[model samples]
Target: MSRFMSAALCALFVFSMTTANASAADAPGKAVYDINCSTCHKDGVMNAPKLGDKAAWAPRIKQGIAVLTKNSITGFKGKVGMMMAKGGHPNLTDAQVKSAVEYIVLQSK
Candidate 1:
């Protein structure tokens, strides 16, 4: 391969890795969210509020992150739907639940 081609490939690889790391850092809770919240949130199951749906999430967002985290950890019964404690995974830690909530809020808003 040409020297220029090798350098370009190396740069591309570095950029790809950097981008992936940046995204992961940006959404620190994404892993937790995927495991615990995606099932319901992704599809809006039982009116859980679909992830990234601004309309559905607007009111919830207005409630603020603290409220959202609390509800996720303790569970909530709202007018339209419910959220299970730790997203039905009781084994999850408080930090995990909070992280998931943060991720949801980030995606939502």
Candidate 2:
């Protein structure tokens, strides 16, 4: 191949690899939850909902997914004892919080 063509091909390959790596790093909701919410939710600390504990989560789940997502994103005040906004992870986006909440609810159910 010509020098210019080779350089272009290499640039394309590098860009593709970078995009793939970024997507992989983004991962899914469960991973985000584990990293952020798990600190309290998993162990039931501070009255936070415990993962896979249907009894504890049933009423919250009953409130519906929309309510749950709203509370999660906006932060629950005096609900389920005490929950901070975005589970104290301000960097987490609303979509990420919703996904994490869904993952938690699914596991609880």
Candidate 3:
């Protein structure tokens, strides 16, 4: 094959691989939350809000997304209890934490 054709094929291969990796990484937030937060949050341990429990989540939900996201990322010790940094997952990106919070909020609602 010509050099130009080989280069094009290489580029296409790289593009396809990158897209596949991105999609794999983009697995739903609920899955992330289940793997991470559900340990405590699912059963309301340490006063962590239980999944799908709107009443338990109501007050925090009222605080709005921005505040909740901040708390989730930075950690907080509030009247309810302590939330660890990144919900104790230091490796989680801010976007991932936000997505997890969104999943929780959606389920709670």
| TM-scores for all predictions | 0.74, 0.74, 0.74
lDDT of each: 0.88, 0.86, 0.88
lDDT of 3 by residue, 13-88 (tens): 9999998678647665776798789998998899888999988889989999889999999998988789899889
The Cα RMSD of model 3 versus the native structure comes to: 5.0
Off by over 4 Å in 2: 1-27
Clashes of 1: 0
lDDT of 1 by residue, 1-109 (tens): 6999999999999999998789668776997788778999999899889999999899989999899888889999998988878889999889878888888888888
**Model 2 TM-score, 2 decimals:** 0.74
**TM-score for candidate 1, residues paired by index:** 0.74
Minimal lDDT window, size 10, model 3: 23-32
- Worst 10-residue lDDT window for candidate 1 reads 19-28
